[model samples]
Target: MSIATSPLPPTEAKEAAPFRPKAVTDFASAGLNPALIESLVLKYLLGVGVASGRKVAHELGLPFGPFPEFLRGLKAQQIVTYTDAAAANDYHFSLTDAGRARARGYLEECAYVGTAPVPFADYVASVEAQSIATENPKEADLRRAFSDLLISEDMFRMLGPAINSGKGLFLYGYPGNGKTSIAERITRCFGTTVWIPRTILVEGQILKLFDPANHEPIENVRSSLLREDDQDDRWVEIKRPTIVAGGELTMEALEIYYDRDNKICEAPLQMKSNCGTFLIDDFGRQRMAPIELLNRWIVPLEKRYDFLRLPNGKQIRVPFDQLILFSTNLEPKDLVDEAFLRRIPYKINASDPTEAMFRRMIEIFAPKLGFREIDQASVDHLIEHHYRRINRPFRCCQPRDLLLQVKNYCIYNDLPLEMKPEYFDFAAENYFTVL
Candidate 1:
């Protein structure tokens, strides 16, 4: 199906870029009907004993289109009986004995009662509609994304094209540089949020897609200004998700997670990050071997879609529509062979901050910490005495880390927060304890 996705040029970052599913006002537009969703509402009512029809609609994140009628139909069949009309959409309903038995049967099969899930076909259409690779990020967008962080113009130039690729990129550099920080801010470049379903149904199995901990839901204030006649609450608008998986990422996490006991299916990490960025932080430090992890991703990265096996042993294809980032302190060469690396087109070096850039970072950060403006003297003192004498190279995090130490020292000593050579010495001494 031809779904309407916004063609967001890099300059259009300020504009809305969500996959606006049009004309989704009624049960038909939602891609499911009363017959499909009513059972879930019945199961929900059985679980809670009694709830309003509007409350049921709210809980399901579906419209009352044909649903109030569906409930009335249940009442006509003597399966549901309204106890009272407390308020608008506040009619309390309860299931009859037969209804309870049927609800129990549904529960025995699977107990998922929240949000009448969007059909898997709709989800796939939405993903294709808002593919991250389609965004053409301009230099302005990059600047806006990293405006808070002290990024050099050269670094911005390198990052603009790499991030625009939206395929995959290796952010490799020393540990203390801004690889993680850069990865974190990559989502800001798109400056757009997309719609994602909380749950998806496929071949009688329900896979939960939206993760509250990971997906930050954008509050809908502009829906009141839309042309679709109304908003489809089933589709949640979330920030272009930036899912960061660190050293703990396992091979199991890359595939669909089926609960043998609960019989529920949770979407893989890639599924959660559709139309956004997926960062594999501290890349080679994962519990699994680097080769094994790289090999697992070889298909998803290339095909831009993933194949997942359902509980019924049926395989399904899901859109791999995210910019997968691998951030590592390890050198890219030592980690993966050429064949694997070939799939990931862009590899940008998060090189250590230059001395000038390092100083500027301090100047930028010191004031933000409520300290007086840092002077050239403090910068010179750090480079000449602490760095040059100790043979220490500058890292991007040092300025912020050193300031943090100085702030703590000032707090303990009851002194004003300001940058001084002595404070630098104290901070550097403690900060480089391992070195």
Candidate 2:
């Protein structure tokens, strides 16, 4: 299928450019039913009571070509009447009694009244065009994405190829070792932004896709008031998503969610994370068994497509093109059998940091935590007394946690923001007691 593409050139340096969806002028080009568009106009008019032709078109995100002519046909049917003259040769329209009744019937079926949903076929094409598998992250891209972390050279080298693979991987180790953090940053290596439909329409069911909580929308700038944007407003430009699902994830979340009350459908978690990354954080800790969850995604992980059943019992295939990262505190072998393990090709251990790396973390975090200076003596004292003496293994998160304790103590005791050996002792005593 020939899909419409945006004319805007890529602005991001080095990152893979995303495929932008361009504006469509007619119902056929927009992949919308003329009958459906007419119903939407009436519904919108019923809601607001009175609105201009341009306003109705804008609200529906169908701002160009033959839409005004289409609205004129409603005026002929006596369903819409002109209330007042609007600018740009348009008129304010209100729904007649018959029109309101028709809209009420439409609402009874489904009350969706937003940007007309992109057709499912169009959404599938967008995912394939912007698939993460198409992008290859060099060492520079990895370094840029993970610049904030203190990753050792060996770990850095291991991550690049896995990200390049674009299949899936496991990040397993003990807790507080940056498994989730690493998974979240993996999307940055691919690109900065991608385009997704605000909602998708399949067999007349609206599937709400663009989520403000998970997807951050980038607003479009108009070049002039005389001309509308050439790009499709139905598709939102968003930062490359890194959707994290943890212990709260349920088996139901991996499928289509139909809201019986609203008569609308919500795209599942994997659908929301398309063209980017989906991090299953605290993987083994979810309510479902690891094997069950693995079974659900086993086919999609390899085939790069998924099947979802609508409330009407009709099945549809959607592109499952995302970098899946499974992060857990438990070992991979303990979570699933060898067959499942083979699917997730890379298993990188988030091992405990060396004493030197731990010290570096302390040095990096000390200043950020309001310590005026790092005392080499105080750090050495902290390591020797708190860690070495107790035979405590160093976790990557200890520096930040220990420093917060010391900082809070300084505030409580009205002491200077200095890293004193005594402060380290106090912090270590309180911080390590539970762990």
Candidate 3:
């Protein structure tokens, strides 16, 4: 659960109309049948035993419009009766025997009882309005996203156009060269935040969308604060999502995952990553073969939309409107065919750092790793003996990783936290013992 709570960057002059889901003011605007809403209300009451009219409405994320008035209709039919008055002239209501039986039936059908789901149509509209394809990131945006890393000018030039393509690219080369790090930060080049539904209602089925493990919510932040009830609560504002799937990825993960006992569904990874970025890390080493995964995404890559079948076998078209990055140690040509390679326009190699760049990284990371300062002699000794002697290539990650090993050794031995030639030798001896 990566949390991106940073303030959004300045918008470009050509920004499109901002997307905001207005509070649904009626049953029609909610796009849900009244009977469905009624069933939800009853199920909520059955679970809690008793709650205020306003509490129920608030729990359901429908505090506006005729939702309260509809509750009165339930009271009129003796399904619910007022126990006591609540704040703001609301009433404490409890379910009758008939209501409890009905709620049990509804539970038997599907037991989901959290935030009300936004209609599938509304969700589709939101994705189109907030798609990353509309974004045009300039050099400044790329620099800001990669501010922490040392990006060479040539690499920056290659990355800017690739990010702007929004179709995605392959970040391929040697391992430990920051391919994953670069892929993770690419989303920051686009807009910082976008709204997504907590859950989606499609064809009478509820699909959970707001995964706490993937989406980070931005509370009380909105485009405007003038109106108290300006935006819909059904939708949550999240830091533009960067969903990463590495070696553990499987074919089942690409489709709608249904929980039989809960009678609930979790949206596919790509669906949750709409309007943001999806990184397929360690691409060739997934649980499934590379060709199988590539075949699954061929149409979505070309069409910018995907078709996913529901549990009932009905196929639904969903927007595939995210930057799909594939990060791998293997070469793009070796892992995928030319046809597949053509789909991904850019194939930027994350080459190993030059000797000078490697030393620069050591200088930058030493103090951050709690070393007071580093001497030139230790760096030279490290490069000359540990690297040159073994004919070892320089990796962008070696500076930090090797430094950590030295630091840990010093801490264990109660020695001063300073880089010394002896420490580098000790660190490299242990570090390079493995492949």
lDDT of 1 at 63: 60
Q: lDDT of candidate 2?
A: 0.88
Clashing pairs in 1: none
Off by over 4 Å in 2: 1-18
**How do the residues 1-435 of candidate 3 rate in per-residue lDDT, one tens digit apiece?**
999877556564346468988877777787878888888899999999999876776787775457568888998888898888877677799999988888899999899996788999999999988989989989999999999998778899999999999988999999999999999899899978999999999988999999999999998755542223777878899999999999999999999999999799999999999999999999999989899999999999999999999988899999999999999999888899988999999999999899989999999999999988888999999999988987999999999999999999999999999989999999988988985
The segments of candidate 1 whose C-alpha lies over 4 angstroms from its true place after superposition are 1-18, 23-29, 33-35, 86-90, 222-229
Model 1 per-residue lDDT at 407: 95
How far in Å is the alpha carbon of 181 misplaced in model 3? Answer: 0.3
Cα lDDT of model 1 by residue, 1-435, tens digit: 899998778666535555675545567777776666767877898989988877787788766555678888898988898988956554778999988987887777787778777889988999887878778888888888888898877788888888887788999999889999999999988758888888888887889999999999988774532222456677788899999999999988888898876667999998898889999999989889999988777998888988888889999988988888999998899999998889888888888888888888888888888887766788798899988887888899888898999999999999988878898889988988897
| Clash number by candidate, in order | 0, 0, 0
For residues 129-199, could you state the per-residue lDDT of candidate 2 as single tens digits? Answer: 88788788899999999999999898998898899999989999999999988898899999788999999
Give the poorly placed runs of model 3, Cα more than 4 Å off: 1-13, 221-228
lDDT of 3 at 163: 93
- Give residue 120's lDDT in candidate 2 (0 to 100): 91
Worst 10 residues of 2 by lDDT: 9-18
Candidate 1 local Cα displacement, residue 249, angstroms: 0.2
CA-RMSD of model 1: 4.1
The whole-model lDDT of each prediction reads 0.84, 0.88, 0.89
